[model samples]
Target: MSIKVENLKHIYAPNTPFETIALDDINIEIKTGEFIGLIGHTGSGKSTFIQHLNGLLKSNYGKIFINDLDITDEKISLTDVRKKVGLVFQYPEYQLFEETIEKDIAFGPRNLGLVEDEITQRVKDAMQLVGLEYERSKDKSPFDISGGQKRRVAIAGVIAMKPEILILDEPTAGLDPKGRDDILRNIKEIHEKEKNTIILVSHSMEDVAKLADRLLVMNRGKVEFFDTPKEVFKHEERLKQIGLDVPKVLDLAKKLREQGFDISDDILTIDDIKLEILKNLKEK
Candidate 1:
């Protein structure tokens, strides 16, 4: 589903001494099935902005349209909107409350009033999408699983709803390298197979560089840049001013270029840089 935000504004503690502008006239359009990477410093309104997408937060000013339907309209049902836009917050495992893994993942679909057979199918599909073996894990307690498994169960709960637009906020936060890789790979597979719109909010530049089709950079409640990763990373100085950095591989490529190596600025991954170095060695 496509999302369009126009002149969106949000405030905290409005009309009070502690009032703050959390989102300032933000405007952006996300096309259908696009993978967008949202990056910004802490408190830069990244969280606040995403909360508006699924109606968790209301804007003080402006309209938000989902697939051309005005979600900001009072006539629109937030519940219905949420069905189309699923949001998985950081450490979603903390929200798991069902006695068994199957029940936990089934919660959203069950609430949608789906039939028993359909709900069961959704639960099974969600677990498989996240790499969980349904028969073995369904009866297990959510709390009895490892941290990464718990995280997958939490994500599967949201996936069971079959949202067209999925927003994941720092999905890999606090996990070890292997755990993080596992979750990220699952997410990539989900996007590839489902072809749904995904907005990934991440702190790791490398992750976004590899996954996102476009990068949306926020700065102090405003858009600093929105472009392809290669284009956005071109402004290394500007990103640094906002306390952001290019992927380490890109940074290394830049250093190599300065030393008279024929490194392409388009290189965004370690594998890309490695291949380029090998190609150059072959040419020599």
Candidate 2:
């Protein structure tokens, strides 16, 4: 499914002396089966915008459409909207409360009122999808699992519902290096296998640079750039001006370019930077 937000506006503590505009005239579109990254500094409205996607927060002004359905319509069912656009908030693992891992992962499907057989199947599929072994972890306490596995179990809870559009807000906020990498890889695998729209909100430039096919940079409640990663990162100076930095390798490539090398400004991955360096060395 696709999603579109037009002229979206949200104000926290509106009309009071503490009024704050969290989002201002925000516009965005996500095509079906696309992987999109939403990046912004703290208090830049990134979280505010995603909350509107699944009706977690109603917009003060503007409209949201999910596959031609106006989510803002009073007659619309938010339950259906949420089922289609599942949101996994930051530190989702903290919300797990069931006694066993299987029960925890089954929570969403059970809430959906799926039949017993279907719920069991969903729990099994979701556990496998997140790299958890169903036969091994089903009866164990989720709290006893490793930190990374616990996070995966939490993600599997949402995956069990099988939403068409999955939105993850800061999925790797507190994980260690390996945990972060594992979560990112699992997310990529899920997106490719499910062929669903994926919206990832993250502060790590490196993570988004590697994962997202398209990038949207937000600044002060406004979209600064919305394009492919190559196109967005090309504006290195502007990104830095807004307190966002380019990927580490891209920054290094820019330094190389400043030294009179013929490296392309669009270089993003470490492999791309290596190839450019090798090519330049060969040229000399």
Against the true structure, what is each candidate's TM-score?
A: 0.98, 0.95
Lowest lDDT block of 10, candidate 2:
264-273
Cα TM-score of candidate 2 = 0.95
Candidate 1 residue 70 Cα shift, in angstroms, is: 0.5
Residue lDDT tens for model 2, 71-104: 9998999999999999998988899999999999
Q: What is the lDDT of candidate 2?
A: 0.91
Candidate 2 residue 47 C-alpha distance from true site, Å = 1.0
RMSD of each: 0.9, 1.5
Pairs in clash, predicted candidate 1: none
Error of 2 at 279 (Å): 4.3
Error of 2 at 181 (Å): 0.5
